[model samples]
Target: MLGVPKDEKPTWISRLAAQPAVHRAIRTFRLQELTSAALKVRPIKRRLPKSGIEYRVRYLESFLMADEIFQRKIYREAFEGLDVRSFVDLGSNVGYFPLFAVELTGRRDLVGIAVDGNRSMTDETRWHVDHNHLANVKPLWGIVGYPSDVKEATFYLNPSNVSCSAQPVLNPDVPSKGRIKEVTVPTVDVASAWMQHAGDVRVDVLKIDVEGFEREVLRTCGALLDKTSSVVVEWHKWIASQDEVEALLRDRGFVRFRTISEDPYCGVAVYRPRAS
Candidate 1:
């Protein structure tokens, strides 16, 4: 994979872009407002600065996500000092985090698997992988759950948003007209699915953002949890409190390093194996 451009703008530019004041100003000033409004009818390709990778996205959700992953450096701390050769992404929306990982690691042979329950989101993720010639990253479409939970599951799709969930009531916007679409998707175990792609190789990093199904998704990892070096998770407060999230990981022999971000809806934290 090609590296960040030498002539790319300074890191401060990205820091500035990540600031809340600047983000609000950009929206308030109608900088992206007009463009975003126009793009609602059709999606467009936007490149991440420095990485030379372009992602195909339609709504403001993706724009905000791009800024969070690339500009805000949301997962940077989780990735630092780790030898990331293989990664697994659960509930990958447009697959920005996997792409960011590849760039941050600067590893040409890194392998990534991005899994999403939404077929459209999977297609979008595939486009990014193919367009950027990221052959090592594989996008799989399926609902990740415990191995014995169900063979097929109902996935509540949020057409206007990427944060779909198995729990119908999880999306607050679902009460509105035509906002939610119910679809049955095949379910796969996380460890089993990953083993099919990378065999028995240890996962360097595992990222989870599965709406309100974080605990169920984590259950599917099974023994692979022992083989993973670090985990970055965005836990929904309604499904599990921050302490509950920590307790779940603790039972699996992982300890929380620190939280990256926290809001009413969800919080992101990094975890590593407990020291002997």
Candidate 2:
């Protein structure tokens, strides 16, 4: 449906203008921070980038939180300039990037599968897909991680953020990484979920952003990787070293296309590999 804009709109300013001052005052502490946070977690309705279809969007909570830590646009740019007709989004947070990438493929026949451990986030993803008249996107909620036979595990729900991860968190300054309460969620084997939701379609883009569970998830995804054309991953060094991550990609015939500094502890990698 679309690609990056030739002249991107100054979204930060508009996001602030759209929010009433009373709401911002009640939830937010400063105006500059609100504008800065307008970059990634968009919860507003705008035309779906290039789809020419008006969508009902759910931007991140505009109240009680000032910003989003995850930069969704970086993933958008990573998926660009590819032949991605279909995609799989792991750790799908309210289906932001998958929906964006669905528009990016500019293909009406594409299949989009969004997976998340959080039920609420999955519901939101499903709602966005259905309400936007997009029959291509599907949202699946279950626990998925590095372990193959993980029957069940504790899922940390960050009440304050959309990206509540699977790992135990400490810092409160990082949005969802803090204020977590553990709850048991049903686990789904990655391969099983892939077979069930993805069916037989070739997935062009396989994205993994499972907080700190990237290693095991990637380790078991060799066969899926063999069929995938590209990958977008947020590899955190705290969970696994960068050297280890790079080596894993190298062994799998995935050449890193772009690397964006996400933080001191984490980095986003976009990869292109041989079409098997």
Candidate 3:
């Protein structure tokens, strides 16, 4: 019998079959190595520059993350041309946004009033302000609601989840697993807070991010919005319907208002109407 040709041999068939498997294994190994290298280099690539205010953020990255910095950047761009002499940071947990505003605007004349419903959060904000030697930023402990000076309310305090609000979050379905400590604190409207100061303070930007209580905050700040040049708020659907918020602002002469993004948790809207 004549021997089979090498190309047509059984051994050759077996080798060809093995070749693809070998190549696939090699490719998989290479991909794994590439992923490992990327994981190693990612942190270094994300490192902020050595100088400037961004570098200072590195000191407090645990408290404030990259997403928060990006949010502040968005706020800065939204109010670029306007002269922002005063800023009201409603629900200013740990003072990240307000501090970032101070850095971006480079306006020492800017006075930031940081209001937080949580006492510990306001205390933390005070610590950061004092540590950074930011004289203009004032931390106040209270909820921004229907203009009032009362010191007693069922202030719900979540020790672990400190950013959660003292006021009942509009979403009752969402479970608050964190502990609630009933703390005593004052409540005031955004307008009253501005009025308490000695001089005729012109509010250029009002940033409200009070979880799901944004609706009540806006209702209380009606007078302040009338005086403010721009109002930036993280709108929540659970808190108030879009139409209701729009109508409220419209009634206060906020003719031009638009949502910046559709982020579920942190959707931002900028309201710029004719100055009063």
Give lDDT tens digits, candidate 2, residues 32-120.
34542573365555565576544433443422111221222446656667677788888876666655665666665567778888887
Score candidate 1 by TM-score against the native. Answer: 0.82
TM, every model: 0.82, 0.74, 0.70
User: Which pairs clash in the backbone of model 2?
Assistant: 1-106, 42-59, 43-58, 43-59, 146-216, 146-217
lDDT of 1 by residue, 1-276 (tens): 011122333345444533457645654665554565777578777776666777766655676677667765678778877878999888888778777886788764678789898997888788878888888889999888757557899999864345587766563322322357899998877787778888999898888888888887776675778888899888877677778778878989999886776644567888999872
- Comparing 2 and 3 on lDDT, the stronger one: 2
Error of 2 at 91 (Å): 1.1
Candidate closer to the true structure by TM-score (higher is better), 2 or 3 = 2
- Model 3 stretches with alpha carbons more than 4 Å out: 1-66, 70-72, 159-163, 170-179, 264-266
1-276 per-residue lDDT for model 3 (tens digits): 011122232334224322445434534565324543464354222322321333222121222233344332556544767877788888776566665666667654468688887765677678766766668778888778655655455566653233366565534433333346776677855577677751467788888877667777777777787778888776666666667777887888885455565433335677887553
Model 3 clashes, total count: 0
Model 1's lDDT to the true fold? 0.73
TM-score of 3: 0.70
Error (Å) of candidate 3 at residue 39 is: 23
Error of 3 at 248 (Å): 1.0
